[model samples]
Target: MRVRPMLLKAGGVFVLLVLASCTLSGCWDRIEVNDLATITAVGIDQYSDNLIELSLQIYTPPQGSSISMQGGGSKGSSSQNQSTVISATGINFADAVSKVQEKVPRLLFWGQNEVFVFSHSAAKQDIAGHMDYILRVPQIRGSALVFVSRTKAKDVLALTPQLRSSSADVLEEVSNLKIGLAMSAGNFNIMLSSSKGTAIMPSIEIMPAPEGQPQKRYPAITGCAVFKDSKLAGYIDDNITRGVMWFRNEIDMATATIVTEDQGGIISARLNRGRTRLKPRISNGIWEMTVGIDTREILVQNTSNTDVAELKGTRIVEEGLKQEIEKRMNRTLQIVQKKFEADVFGFAEAFHRKYPKIWNKEKGNWEEIFPHVQVKYDIKTVIVNPGKRTVPTNRMEGEKG
Candidate 1:
């Protein structure tokens, strides 16, 4: 009996000791926040003599006194100066990053990075090389938004805007608004790796500040950069970009303005919701594609004297809206198909799904066949609402229809 009791006490003491040892062990990979340079954005450019330039936007915390004073105690000062831009050059992307690391006092950390930008020259020459480095990095997030700058990408990072602390914040907020196609690093990689190996990324440019304003310039996401075979092919304006969006079934929101000749005025409608469908068919060995668009819009502004609440008035306005949409779609198709000869739209995927046997045989020559593929459009538009008033308040007596 005495031996049994002693054994039980020894076992209990061993269990306690194991638990205490677990709690006493310290984390081996722990890093203090104060010793890190948290990167918010990255920019890449091509330099002469086969070199690469890397730029980083690192967040810098305010002084201790400034922090305490602005910590809910004061409203006059703002935290707009929280980031700084630094640059370095090397033979390749990784080498350039290493050189940048040598210059930075603290360890460069990319876990907080939100934006990646490439200059036009860099994008045209070796965007794929840049992307490879970004994908292989363990600390970098795959969801970081990507852009191509018309000017030197480093210039974009150096901008100072009154609304946001850094250019990265402004670009990220705008991307979320769905005004244009929002693509991340992962999304670009997938698109480039697909069967077609074609992709598009939002393009940014510097817009001069308003005349007589204190600020020199601001950055704007204006258009798209189209890629063919993982290389930059060309760029398109906002109007053409929207047309591409329509074919991809990616339009989140848009506004259209139509002028009514019969009513002698202009009307504006806001797109509420929209959906697109692509039907692929082969007739007598000829590839034909029919695009169907179903969209709903609300009349937000009626400058004409026509009462859109009436059925006849609504029908007239609806027809005009349909024609306007058709025109945009046709123009976009002509440009992407006939002019650019690139299938940024995933028409190849649709064909692959419907006719796998034929797709496999011709997948290699899709580049040649895509430009000749006959396309047709069928669009339907409905006027869901006519706003608060049926007619314009500023309508003249003679303008009434």
Candidate 2:
């Protein structure tokens, strides 16, 4: 009887404790969706010497909308003007963000944020410090795309995306396609970590839309920002950017146009697979690096005399292609080494990896050494297809024209 009574009391106390814990846990970390001020993109512009302009695209929740949040497009905006974009000035990024929120009624939430565009004025300034702000911030997504806008950063964000709700999605897919060099906070992290203290970022320009189009258009990559020791060194053209891509072994979907003396027309080849190997050697106490690239090609466009039946002609075409590719790669190397004086190719990293002892002795003089580093290229290309033409379309001189 005594044991039964004690068991009953213990059971009642346990049940009460369990119910209380459940109630507490359920209520914890709960925030209403209505309270979140969703920021789609953050744009920074140089306002003055002492202050910077910040713009935020914020979504306004509808009061009586019945559409579900899971739907592809947001029904949160009640009308054309319901969604809002606002701007404010502050000396620092955090301050600017806080000021922008003062006018916004809801709490600023960046979990859905997708991009940060630095104005040309802002980017022209020492942006290592500015980029640092984004790196250290906890609320921002690292995957968010980073762009250097040719025009004001705010204008890029204001271009209304017709199909998508935000420009972020468009840029995200563009970066993935390797349309040019990938420039994002995540990629910046890798760039910042390079031992050579150089980084390259893709430059995006805004162009006028077609006559009938209301919105402005963002064109393909045309420029690259060069960085030396975390400061803006200068910018390079698209050709140099392609060279950089080749050296970095990150070339994707690049078509090379090669002209052969024997071939009547230009033969274009698209690289399917390519690998760049950096080999370092010490010759007579001097360090040298060789960049070997192995590429497999598929014939894309042939506008010349393509002889499919003539195996000898195909061989000649392949040799010509190999020479052309090698020439382009070597030319790119010269610009990077002799002109740019930028070790964007990781020659230093290659040396450090191969000859650590030599690197220790020569690390101090890398700047002076890079320009003189004996770098050579060996490119191997295999042409797998001849396109539609197998036999000679334009016959040899012996054959009838």
Number of the top-ranking candidate, with lDDT as the measure: 1
Collision count for each candidate, in order? 0, 4
Model 2 / residue 336 / CA error / Å: 3.3
Q: What does candidate 1 score on TM?
A: 0.92
Candidate number of the best TM-score: 1
Overall lDDT per candidate, in order of appearance: 0.88, 0.74
Assess the local accuracy of residue 154 in candidate 1 as a C-alpha lDDT between 0 and 100.
93
lDDT of 1 by residue, 299-320 (tens): 9988875689899889889999
**Displacement of the residue 302 alpha carbon in candidate 1, Å:** 0.8
Q: For candidate 1, which ten residues in a row score worst on lDDT?
A: 72-81
Among residues 3 or more apart in sequence or in different chains, the pairs in candidate 2 whose N, CA or C atoms overlap within 3 Å are 265-304, 307-392, 308-390, 308-391
